[model samples]
Target: MRAGPLVVVGDTLLDVDLQGTSQRLAPDAPVPVVDLAAERPRPGGAGLAAVQAARLRTSRETVLVTPLADTDDPDALKLLELLEAQGVRVVRLPLSGRTVRKTRLIAHGRPLVRVDRGDGRLHGRTGLPDAAAAAVRGAGAVLVSDYGRGTAAHPVLRALLEELPGEVPLVWDPHPRGAEPVPRARLVTPNREEARTLAATARTARSGGYAQAATDAAALRARWRATGVSVTMGEHGALLCTGDQPPVLVPAPPVPGRPDTCGAGDCLSAAATGALAEGALLTEALEQGVHHASVFVAGGPAPRGSDTAEAEPWDLVRRTRLQGGTVVATGGCFDLLHPGHVSLLHQAARLGDLLVVCLNSDASVRALKGPGRPVMGQADRARVLSALGCVDAVMVFDEETPTALLERLRPDLWVKGGDYGPLELPEASLVRGHGGQVLLLPYLEGRSTTRLVQRAHSEGGEER
Candidate 1:
């Protein structure tokens, strides 16, 4: 939502991933032995939705409002730090006792076991006594990500139902263990199984299919007084139901190779919430949610990592181009990443909808800078640059100039650091011929990569 901030209220959690290979069965137990090789930790539940929503919004601000379980809770502290590092504004409620933590052990790229700990304990329901109601009242859109933790029960539920402004759109990812969302919610999204369980809870009996799913969604919509409900039917797609309207079928886009859809639902909820915040209508938001979920599941299957965002640039670039979004391209040896490079990237990103950094391939860098010039390999450079929030995509080009890649991409904007004048740019004519504007961003003084490299060499000699 570009209009105003998106406020998320729900239980926050920490998700940890233990990845390794398992070949043999354990002697002591029936479970397989998982040889842990890597560990990754990330924000989960509402915290995850906040990050997803923030990324989807691109230019809009997102605020996560939740209560920490305890002051000394390691997960809680880590969650705060992670959110802060990702540029999300967090308004934590009064601390209760413990933050929820979920640890998953995976072997051979599949999860073997999951261990969950901590209680979703928020101190009180006084509408998040500190930052809850205030944020809800001022939010452009609000999302309730109930994870069956104690936080989304009666008190906090009522506070949210009462405090959130009437005009704000609300999307709830309902959990049976949690209290029902307000009837005024724009949409209540539940998976097919959850929808079936909810239907049985409502004492309604029928079959389970796309047809039955619509009926079930309608029943829940009526029960909760919500305007609509959509049941996500995995690969079968999603069934949407609004008051007296026919069920709209949103097909799931195909994902290549093995599908990792663990967080697809969360991505849908986050995308829908952002669209609603941006004032999208019910049908539009639902469709947008489905499309985003497809994109997410295609790239993002891991639970505790942003590996999905590091997908092939071609796919993302084509998608952005198809959407009629502005595409900006810039290139560099990127031998050493410094604040000046980051500044130029940030500014380039602001000039367009998507920023693509055409990194120099290993051979290209070696050709341009001589031997021992590139301190890192092409892959390492691409990985480091891809980690930046401003750089949407990174691709390595083998050519000395990015003219060929720019010609293929036909970028709407070609951005260069201020160090280069218009005539000094080798690819300026090609970009201009393609009707692309060549913009030179100011380079920060005393931030040259060559200077940094020379200084390091001089220092090493001094020590010798």
Candidate 2:
């Protein structure tokens, strides 16, 4: 599904985290000293919401508006860099107060002490309201992430909502401490405790029983005049309440084992906003949100991790060597099947004992060419490639560049057509990076698929 443009407004903070291991007790004090391994900073608050929005709206544009201090906070800069890398547009409003920073010390995968600095307020900021309203006006939907740091409050949120088109959806993640004068929002996402607080009821009565939780969710939705309400119940999944529709229970996908449950809520809110922007019903959006949260809880490619622990290219190399096969690799769009393609496949097969053709998926082809191109579908192309006796395996990639896939495959030899320049091949650097050699095969000059298609079109002939 295609993603749509989303505008995210909320509190912006910096997360400074320290990671280390605890060794023998310190002699000076009766406390365990953690040997610092590394310290890192990431985007938190509204910046974090923007980052999450970028991930969900892969196709659509994302704009984030938040306040930052001119004091040159390294953590704030890192967050900006990350948002820029994800192609998210950011508008920074300068503030006189220091940028909020939350520093957490983690020992053996557990959080120790969390120190917070800076008051979470706009603090006599100029032009921020106008800039934020402009951002909201340009979006299909707006998401407000209220970390209770004071970025998302009455006046700012009311201004933002008024600026948006009436049909445009508004989603809010409310904070308990500052729930007064709730902004008019289409959807409100709150955890069980937050929902109880918003409803001004006992936390245990609201969350202790399933029936009570459902009652609380409905009451809160009605009180806030929201069209939809989603209460995220960690481990148990989420409960959704919508106007005129039966309440839907979205069960969390099974997490294989114990997991570090950080960033799950952020992921959920991002996915839900994306799904809603795509015109999905509330239930469908809730399901998609749960799915996204499950992936993060399962330790997927999250911002918190240093590097993804994927199988190294050498591992695949060793496995292929053990099978006593010479691995052959080739790549192309393979849009239309023709005699030249058949001939090239045979030639590539002869160069090695086994041939693996990497076929670009439909999305990849569309990215390379325009949307009107890719005359054939990915499945058909894969079927044709696999049917050829010269081809052993067919793999598909959805990236415009196959550098990541090539780095993973690490074939013994990489082959390409003579038509492409040595440097033009997408996998050229990757092949050479791991000491693999690249070879160019001779092309049948006249037997081109483009020429064949042109001839057929001119002659009023169809080849299928």
Candidate 3:
């Protein structure tokens, strides 16, 4: 089964990156004149969180509840189109002013200057729409991406957020100017500077260094009445404080150089919220968030429109299809990741431009191969598969068969490694019905997970 829909509530903005080459200073002024090459526009703030959520949880629905200017406004229209293209469903609230847009001038992947303009605000008189309220109430997990643009401060929306059941995970990414998160929030995340400011305003002790951040986190959690508080310290990582337990520090993986961290915070919150929606423990969620954010930053900014490290599988499929490139897909448990699997995947990759692996979820693997099976969990398995140069994307499915996922992907070619043919294979008919070709290649001789496991057990008992 798919995870419940992810609801991101807060303000939305239009973010644009103007990329160009800057070689020398202008003759007229001391400033360097940039030769513009490309313009990349993407959803910002809550819209960005929604896009990130959708990317991380490909099987789950991601919804954004925020205000937007009328479609007549070019920036707003662009934001809507980008969010839609990213597979994020937006529930637009009425806006009282123009859409907020931020433009950054970049040279060689580094931002030179950022320009921000807009007066967009949620219509103060307009109450939360019924549909948006329902979406918030039904969400499996909620992320309040407060950009301090009034949506998080709205009384009606805040009221509804306050009433959400405790069972639903609530992650609040706070802004200095935004309204305080509801007392029911499960987690409150604030950057180092924001945390320091909030702590000082509350008449709490203020000190320097990472040790002080831990103190700030605990103070903020108590003051906000939240279940946990995490203070994010850029490259140093995040310190998480929950309950009476000792704070845990989740450090960032080392990157070679200074990474452009413009949207790294949103990336972190979105990843953590996605993990929570998938029923991961708080600590596990934070670990995943830190790792994803590091990866996102290390990959550098998407100089163009496409995100480099965290590109959505759906987006890849659409782009490939648009270019008339053949898409190939294969499904399997992929436990242990033996040489047989690698050989088959490499052969399949040769048949198409992009090869997507439909992996069986942990639950599905357990049900099919028994409890002791799947030596690696689904996430680990998927990570290993994605690291393979031959594999383009990894899609996990909970069902016994990947029929539903196949229906969604509708690849041009379906490949499997076995002795089965069109008739013996359960998914062959479905593949053919969709006008897709199915090919079965012989497995590498004497290489299988079952045989490997049996040998391991036999060898263990033989001696040592």
Candidate 4:
């Protein structure tokens, strides 16, 4: 299910998950006393869609045009950084104000409260940069996630859409605050509530006409002049309507247990748009999207978090493999992440569905590079690596070689940077013996950590 060239345009956000436990109640108030321990940050909304679609590896190229305000918010920078790390080409539209950020306080694995920061004035420039428009024009399919941020309402985006080629499939996730599509969208997806409003606004439907899903979808299709309309019904599924055809009732697969539904819609739209870009029929794309959404919900925060707040285990490899996607593994010291490291990681992610980075522990790094090395602690290194979008999971291994870990995970592919395997490489043999492929990426010239360390030492720097 390889996708062709694809583009995703819309709001970009930083989704921060704060995890901890509330064991005691406050004396002054009834609120539980929570001891916050850790936080996880992920790209949200349009950014997330772009990343997930890229993970499908359906296309030779995928690009995300997102408004990124120039700011010093570390978390926000992290969000944008991960997009590229996850292998999605980025066209950054400058925003004058701060980017939107959503932070949640969670007890166990569920969100207890959410705190959103940022004024509604996230727009700066009025039009898409020339590079952005060209990128969209070249895309096989375009997905728009209008989260009511300014990107969806900008003149440049609207103008571009108005002039876009009709053959380019457009999957639009509409929001109330966003501009309407240019009457030629391939599909528009709105939640039940949003659809009701759209139906009422259409005025063709009498009062309370939204109750009839078909009528509402039809009303919206006509109102937006889109080719098709699908109204997502949270628990039930979606009502898909195209032209004169009777709307099909697609039942979402049942989940056995409670799963996180937070970003299910984004994932659904992303998957479907990618499928559509690859020339899947509308029905086929919808079916695939529905299944992808269900699986995502079933796999979400139901059991990932813990009181200890430990990172996900390597054991998830088996689960991911079973789900049928490429899994890539890379082993390295990763003492100080450099440009070359970033490039390697992004390339690695483009090669697979998920990438597992096997990080060498402090002892192992010390043994390999001798004492007075690493510069950064193992925990620090792992934390930074985990923040990368391309590096889906990071595991600290104490062994000198990742051979044992590779044997355990048996990834679909193994990637290493630089070209030095000599006559025989042990890890290569391990990976190849398990019916897996191995590849070596070219090293970014003059971008090694050792060179930087040496430069620092020459500049009166000491081994910390």
> Would you list the clashing residue pairs of candidate 1?
69-97, 69-98
Residue 273, model 3, lDDT: 89
User: Which stretches of candidate 3 lie above 4 Å from their native place?
Assistant: 1-3, 201-206, 300-464
Query: Tens digits of per-residue lDDT for model 4 on 191-252?
Result: 77778776774444454333477788888898888988888886688889897988876678
Q: Find the 10 residues in a row with the least total lDDT in model 1.
A: 301-310
Model 4, runs deviating above 4 Å: 1-4, 120-127, 201-211, 301-464
RMSD of each: 16.1, 11.0, 9.6, 17.5
Q: Pick the candidate with the highest TM-score.
A: 3
* Model 1 alpha-carbon miss at residue 419, Å: 39
Q: Which stretch of 10 consecutive residues in model 4 shows the poorest summed lDDT?
A: 301-310
Pick by lDDT: 1 or 4, better one: 1
Which scores higher on lDDT, 3 or 4? 3
lDDT (10s digit) by residue, model 2, range 201-254: 655533555665677778888888787888888888998888666677899865
Q: Would you list the clashing residue pairs of candidate 4? A: 2-58, 3-58, 3-59
For candidate 1, give the lDDT: 0.77
Top of the candidates by lDDT: 3
* Lowest lDDT 10-residue stretch of candidate 2: 304-313
What alpha-carbon RMSD in Å does predicted model 1 have with respect to the real structure?
16.1
TM-score of each: 0.65, 0.63, 0.68, 0.63
The global C-alpha lDDT for each of the candidates, from Candidate 1 onward, is 0.77, 0.71, 0.83, 0.75
Name the better of 1 and 2 by lDDT: 1
